[model samples]
Target: MSPRNDIQNIKVREERKRQIMNVALEIIAENGFANASVARIAQRAKISKGLMYNYFESKEDLIINIMLDGFNQLTLSFDTNKDGVLTEEELHYFIDSSFETLKNNIHFWRMYFMVLLQPQVYEIITPYLEKTLQPFYETAINYFIDKGYEDPIAEMRFFAAMMDGVGLHFILDPDNFPLDGVKKKMHRMFK
Candidate 1:
């Protein structure tokens, strides 16, 4: 058999890292962030303690990556073309996709909101999340400008807050969430 190439090796590493993060997220969701530990996560992931460090510098780093990835997953549906502006179609898509993501990743979202509820934990992640979401915010603001809003920044803030509230409500009550109704309303409102 041929030896694995660099690309294959990179894929392997990425998958392993993802596995570790998934386990950490599950542990956090089940036990809460404060109770989750590196040793426990590593055990759950079936990786040695030393190897876990290779993927994550520390528990905080792992948690930060999961949080950042969760936000990025939502933002990815926005500005799909990487252009500075967000079109109406993309705006609609973003709203729809955001709800879909919440429905599909309840555990991660639950853990995400749980972490944010604790002031100290939220403080640890605030800077990282702001940095990651900066570009997303810029594109959204540009979208509001294109849509002819008088105050694009305020418009952007409103959009963000709306999304946050919807997500929190869904996580709090997925079974009773009017997910489709909310998505349709958002689409209509945005368009």
Candidate 2:
């Protein structure tokens, strides 16, 4: 094929892959991961099952890839300072940006939590999960240590738990949650 034709073909293929993943995200978000069958995803994407397979090896692969994408999105949203430390200003930025991301991609976050609740799904994405979270985890621990806090590890865990609680409340009641108030309170806690 000509170079131009090759480029066009590549674009088409990427678009098709994105379409399939998008449908898969919606299906899994609306229904549990177990309900998100390959056939169902293909049907939702209006593509053949065989064609979907051409893009993804299996339903597990799709879910893992989607979770990885969500992790990437999260890292992109949170800005860490140049020194690789979570300064007070950076902490507020992280909180605000993360809340913004949750607001914008509420469905994806729902799907993420759904997958997280499934024990089996954990095995599939654990490596990626640890790698993705390591930086933030280390940063929090280091920040606490730098602040001369006793039991820095425990402090970091408390910080993580606090963020988890915020996420849980936001996810459970996105429409009614006092997100700004919560953000301010979180800032104070970390500050």
The alpha-carbon RMSD values of the candidates against the true structure, listed in the order shown, are 1.7, 2.7
- Using Cα atoms with residue i matched to residue i, what is each candidate's TM-score against the true structure? 0.91, 0.83
Instruction: Write model 1 residue lDDT over 138-175, tens digit each, in one string.
Output: 98888888779999999999989999999999999988
For all candidates in order, the CA lDDT equals 0.86, 0.81
Error of 1 at 103 (Å): 2.0
Query: What residue pairs are clashing in model 2?
Result: none
lDDT of 2 by residue, 67-109 (tens): 7887777666444644677787777787888888888878778
CA lDDT, candidate 1, residue 117: 68
Instruction: Give the candidate number with the greatest lDDT.
Output: 1
Worst 10 residues of 2 by lDDT: 74-83
